[model samples]
Structure formats: structure tokens, C-alpha cells
Target chain A: MRYMEDTLLHHLHTNDTEALKTFLFTIEELPLLQVFTSLSANEKAIVFRLLPKDKALALFEALQPTAQHHLLRSFTDEGATEFFNDMAPDVRVRLLDELPASVTKKLLQSLTASERDATNLLLGYERETAGRLMTPEFITLKKEMTVEDALAKVRLQAREKETIYTLYVTDQRKKLHGVLSLKELLIAEGSQLIADIMSHEVIYVATDTDQEEAARLLNEIDVIALPVVDRESLIVGIVTADEGRHILEDEAIEDMF
Target chain B: MRYMEDTLLHHLHTNDTEALKTFLFTIEELPLLQVFTSLSANEKAIVFRLLPKDKALALFEALQPTAQHHLLRSFTDEGATEFFNDMAPDVRVRLLDELPASVTKKLLQSLTASERDATNLLLGYERETAGRLMTPEFITLKKEMTVEDALAKVRLQAREKETIYTLYVTDQRKKLHGVLSLKELLIAEGSQLIADIMSHEVIYVATDTDQEEAARLLNEIDVIALPVVDRESLIVGIVTADEGRHILEDEAIEDMF
Candidate 1:
């Protein structure tokens, strides 16, 4: 293992992209984290660039906030903006919270207009609130959409959405209306109207609700994502079960201490 | 509230099934638990009988083990047998563990042949093992099946299964082959073969693995269920995420004491 690490480091220093790619080809998540962290920020950037986009995103997501900050600094401005923009809005907010004010401002300015707006919306919320903990990248179905139309919409945008498991149904004003699981849509007849089958009893939290409370609700309800609404019952964002688990884990650690 | 409770109890004592049915018509899971627990075991059984089948199942599932046992004792043998048979194998095992040995034997004997076999398979495993924690009620796809055929099979059996979110692929000998999520199946063309889309690299636990370890793996993978395999790699059962979360919460509480 020591000799393998030395050779990998040598390859990194020498820019042996071929050898580094070969080594990284089958590297699992845990070792990838170790290798990424052990390298200097520049070296980490070099190695990260060699990774395929999906793997790079996965590695970036697996990283600690400090490591993520260092990796971001190592990237070119264009690269930084693109990579940061690709991350879920909630993740971007968490990272922004850890950075110095000037760096955070620069990064925020670098985001795409839509990404910047989403981040800004989250940033406006108080810390530890549902607004700060939700991802704005969610798919919303119009109540009038046919099942086929909804499925098509989900398929077209599924790659970029935070979760396609639970789709929220919104009205003309984007007011929270109803919710249905993707499975519900999949099993329904194509011609069926979404409004006819979608559940109107949506369990949701206001944007200002405590994040821990939101997470507990997620657990109790056993839903893939909990919709976070604004004051007017407009669906603003969603807190996923995975994010809820993290908050619960963090609270557990805090309790331990 | 006291007056309402008194009226409800009067209805229960008078065996006013019509009034009890009306009362339970829109009762939610939490309040049902409260009402079920507050009643005498015999009264609980009467109220339970008045509930719709789905609601009764849900209420029984939501009850604490002690409450479940008390309610079970109040049930007539035929009703107990029918109800016991309807539960997923894993849940039956958990409840059996809490009962007196004679009661456990009676319940086991009351199960249908298939349900009894499934429950016995789970009961055979040591406590806190993956085998003991998994439900045998999972849908398995054949590698050669067309996606359409698989979907049909899932739809037909979906009601009886513990979860339809994650489906395991198994070979002729019932050896676990690959796995895929329902979303994957729904997105793919009907003509596509399961072999082409199912992920060959399945993350699973051996039958003897610790339940906590299995639950942690389920959390890490963020999958709906984790397959548990026996010595010959035969897929025995699966642990759903909801069960995993319960195990995790129980462990957290255990730590606090």
C-alpha cells in the first residue's frame, strides 16, 4: 500500500494522467476520499479533473467542507463556477457557510443566475432552518398534467433534479397542492389526470421551521422528501430523507459531546 | 375530550359497531395508536375488528410489542390466525419473540403453510442477525424477463410485498444475481431485458451479519432495501429502510441509557 501510494503520488507530480486514471478506475469511495485528502490542493485538482464527471461529483460530495473549499480554490474560475453550480443548492449553501466572507461572495457571484438566486434564497433564511437545509432543485407537477405528461417531464429533467421519487403537485400559482410518489404515477394509466389521483393531504413544513423538526417529520412520515413551503403555501424546496439522516446523525453526535 | 372519550367508551361497551366505525372512519395512525392503547385489551380487539383491513393492519404494525401481544390475546383464534398470516414474515418473527413460548407456537401453527415457512426461516436465525431482521416478502425478477413482464409481476404482487421500491434479480437456483430500483424499471423501454439494466454490483449482507451493520449499509447505500443472502448466495430476504431506521433509533436510545 505504501509503495502504491508513492507511485500514485509520483504519477500525480509528473502529470501521468494515464497511470492516475488506471489507478482510479476501480478505486472505491472510501479510498478515493483518502487519496483525494492526502494530496496537496493543486494535486487534488489535477486528480479530480482526470475523474469522469459522475465520479468527480461523487468524490466532491463525499469530501469534508475544508477539503471541498481547498479543492474549489485549486480550480480555475470557470471550472469552479461550473462545478459549484452543478452541486445541489443545499450543499452549496452548507459549503458557503464554512468559507470566509470574501471567498463566499466570490463563489456566490460565480454561480449561474438561477443557481445564484436559489443560493441567495437559502442564504436569506436563518441558520438551522428548513430553508437553509432544502434543495431548490425539485420537480413539481402541474395538477392538470396527464400521467404520461408528468412522466415525460420527470424523465426529461430527472438527471438534474434532487429527487424524482416523490413529485409534488402545484397549482397555477405554484401553491402547494398535492403530492404523489413516482410509483403512483408509473402504475397509473397514461390518460389519468394527476389531480384525480394525487394525494391532497400533503405533510409539509414552513421555510422557517427548525431543521431538526423537519427531519423528525421526514422520519415519522417515512417519505423520500419533505416539501418546504413559504408563507403563502408556495412550495419553495424539498428536504430529502438522506439530508434528514445527516441532520439526525449530527444531532446525535452533538448529544454525545 | 373527556366527554368524547366517555362516549367512545360507552359505544365500545355497548358494542355499537356503527358508532365505532364512524369514529374510526377518518382516524389517523397516531390517534388510533392512542385509542387502541387506552382501551382494555378486549375492547381494543372489538375496536380493531371494526376498522378497515388496511387500517387495522397499520394500527397493529404501529403498536408497541407489549400492546400488540395484549391485543393478540384478546383476538379469537380464527381472527388471530387470519391477522397473523397477513403480516410480513419479519414482523411476525419480531412479535413472536416477545410472546410466551406457547402463544408463539400457537401463532406459528396458525399461519398458512407459506407464511409459516417464511416466518420459521427468519426465526431460525440468531437474534439481531440480518436473517432475523429481513422480510421474506420481496419481489424477485428473472434476468431473462422483459421489463414489461417484470412490471406486471410487480403490480400483481405489489400489495402483498413489504416494498416494491427495490427488486432483486435471482437465477434459477434462487441465487442473487443483480438488483435494480423500480424507477429504473419504469424509465426503461418495455422490451428491455432485466439483465441489461440491473446493476451487477449489488451491496448485500450475509445472513449472520449484525443487524446494526446491515442497517448502516442500508443507510450508506441509500437504497430502499438490503438483500440478505445465505451460505450458497441464495437471496433469502430483504431489510427495508423503514426497519433500518427503527433499528438505528432503538440503538440511539440504547446508547442514551
Candidate 2:
């Protein structure tokens, strides 16, 4: 990591774009997909032209909606279709929200049935609200699970989760019981029960809460992320700091002009 | 320099106010008086609170007139008196321009006879023009000097000047004839005269030109700085890229809101 950082700094100092591209290509084996997701629209377009089609589409799905439109306009019909098809349901909904109704209709016609339904469900909420940003990509732990068993379950399910920084603890009825940070789990003795370590005074926002308000609360408290819960207080999804920063930057830009 | 930068970075990151004050106290050997003069009003206030009373007053006098007022409000009568005594004539004029008449009169009374005369001369010019921002700190060279001789003279006089990036090449009458970058001097053979290497096509802004327009002109061209000339096309002062960037940031902030 230090060597890669040093190499990137050297290239930046010399303004060597070719060297930078070579370095980026070599580091594609790492979890660079997350870093690629954080780039601005113009920056993504520049990188997209340098990477493989599949990698480009994967990165595109991770981009903010504004960036998706920009990348789509820069590509041919076949390329655009490949990217649109590979995008996640929640991400697709965000893109559709920004597009004209006629364009949205045409794009919706291209999606599979399940993708269309998932996107439709997400699109029902107003933009810049918790419901619109939340993804149904999280793990729910049953209260009956022992500390050892819960840890094993988390390790098995971690790959598919958005973040494991904060684990949402719920009851058998699917109602959120408490929340626990990953730090507490690592330090706790294996014999200790999960319910003993978890804090029942859970801090979370409702599905309809304003996204800016959610972001502000997270920033004020210096938390890694916040969980979004439904009307019945069941965990829906989490809004991580990376996504919150993107939303904040967008808000700052909007306020600037 | 690297050590100082590291120490400053450490204090900034840790928000260690006491360490910052101690670090500034230890740097008394360096000629910070000139550096303080270049900083904006807001920057001065941030740094001044950490310094001793004597050093603070000396630093305040080095600042521009606009900065002086801002700093004055943060000091006592004794501190203000010491600062006013040390302030340059032209800077005093600039300070009085923005201040209310009642306050300006009180400040003027505090200045010595010679300083008051110099202040009056600078105050005669219109605001937001080259006449307002320019310091009378410049050196004019005869167009006939050998490259070696010119370099030696610059080395001797550069300490008091704002910038030695671009030296104005003038005829015997002190009329601006051409301009030359410091790069030309270092690379030129000893035999060449200043006239031979200097570019006759000098781009300069008039004393009355808008400050923002002057900054834009400097940014558009690949020049280290632009020379500000009076109505008769006599070079007065140079506006460097450092100052240009500061002006651009201010404009960007104003446009932001």
C-alpha cells in the first residue's frame, strides 16, 4: 500500500498520465472498485475509457446517479445497455429519477421483471430521503444466536454486506432489538452473550427521514454509518459515511450556485 | 523548512493551541516580519493571538491597510499605537479608505508627520484598482547592464522586494521598455546584455485597471506575474500568481453564496 501510494504521488508530481494509467491497471486486482466508485463524473469517464467493459459497468453501478447519466451519454448504445443491465435495482431507480419521463420509460422497458419491480418500489420515495438511498443489502441476526454462533454467521455473510462496521441486532419477529459496533464483538469474550454486549438504545432514522438530516446526525456524532428502520422499527438498510460524504458534497455544490 | 512544515502540520491536526504558540515563539530567529505583511486580515488574526504583544504589533504594521483595521480591533490602545507607528505610509492610506471617517480620523492622528503625508498621497487614488493594492517596493534596472552585473544587483536588492520573478527592463529615462523572467537570467550567457534577452512585447495593466481583471489577465497568460504601469506606462509594481490565486479564491467564495 505504501509503495502504491508513493508511486501515485511520484506520477502526480511529474504529471505523468501514462504512468498513472499503468499503475491503476496493475492495482485492479485489489478492492479498487470502491475507489473507482468515489470519482466524479468527468474522472470516471476518463478511467472508463482505460478499463475493460465488465469492470467499467461494475464501477458504473457504484457511481452516483448524476455520474451515471454522464457516463451513459459518453458511450455507444451497446455499451450503455451493458452498463444499464449490470446496475443494481436501487442504483437503477436513482438514475431513472434524474431522467425525463420518456427516457425513464424506455430504460424501464429494458430491465428484467424483478429489477423493474425493485426499482419501482424504491422510486416511490421522494429524492434526497432515506428511502431513496437505502439498499436492501444487509444481514439480520436472530436474538437466539449465541456470541460464537453470531460471529460465525457474520463471517459467512460479510462478503454480501455493504458494511460490517455496525451489526443490526433483531428479534425472531424481525423487529430491531439493539445495535452493536464491530469493535465490541472483537473485544468480548467468546462465552459472553450477544445480547449482553449490544446496546438497546439504538440510534437510527426512519425510512422517510430527510437524507441531509440523516447525514448531519452521522457527522455530528462521528459515526461510521447509521441504520434506516421501517415503520415497525425493523432494520431496512444502512447509510455509510462514504455515501454520506458524496451526498454532502453534492449538497454543498448545490448551495454554492 | 521540512521540520517546520511537519511541526505545523502536527499542531494543526491535533488542534494543539499551546504547542502552536510555543512553536511560533521558537521561530523568532526567522524574519517573519515580511511574511506577516503578506498575509490577509483573517490569517493575521488567527496567527496573532498566539504571539507576544511586541511581536504582534510588529506583525500588524507589516500587514496591508485593510488587514490593519481587522487586527486593530483585536488589540488594546498601547498595541494599536505601536502598530500605527511602524506601519508604512502607503499601507496607512489604504487602511483609511475602508474605515469610517470618525475612525479614520482617530487613526490618522496616531501617525507621525512623514507617515501621514505618504498616507494622504496613496489615498488620492480610486479603490479596487492597481493603485490600491500595489506596494511602492520595486527596483528598476538600466537596460544596458550585462547579465552578470544585473544578477548581482538583483541579489543585493531582492530582500526588500515583493517579487523578483519578472524584472522590468527600462531605458535610461526609466520608461518601461521590455520584461524578462528570472529563468532567462539563469540560463543566459554572461556576454548577453539585458536588452538582448528581454522580451520587448511586455504585457502590463494600467494603475486604474480593475483588480479582478488584472488577475484574469495574469491567469490567462503563462506568466509568473504582470507589471502594473501608471498612465504614462511607467512600471509601478508586479502582481504575482500567488496574489492572483488569492483574488480568485475570494471571487469564488463570493460567487458561491
Q: Which candidate gets the maximum DockQ versus the true structure?
A: 1
**Local lDDT at B18 for model 1:** 59
lDDT by residue for model 1 (A1-257), tens:
56656877887666555667777766777777776777765566556655644576578778777777766556543433444455566654443322222233334434554554444432345568887777766788998999889978886777666588899999765688999987787668879999998999999997779999999998788889998876567776788988898999899899988
- Cα lDDT tens digits for candidate 1, B78-123: 4334444555656544433222222333344345545544444323
For model 1, name the residue pairs that clash. none
Please provide, for model 2 over B29-148, each residue's C-alpha lDDT reduced to its tens digit, 9 standing for 90 to 100. 345554455444434434454464456545555667866675544333343333434446564443322322223233344444345344433233355665555544445667789887
TM-score of 2: 0.31
Off by over 4 Å in 2: A1-257, B1-123
Candidate 2 residue lDDT tens string, A158-257: 6555566577788754578988765455456657788888888888887678999888887666565788875566665677765675787699899979
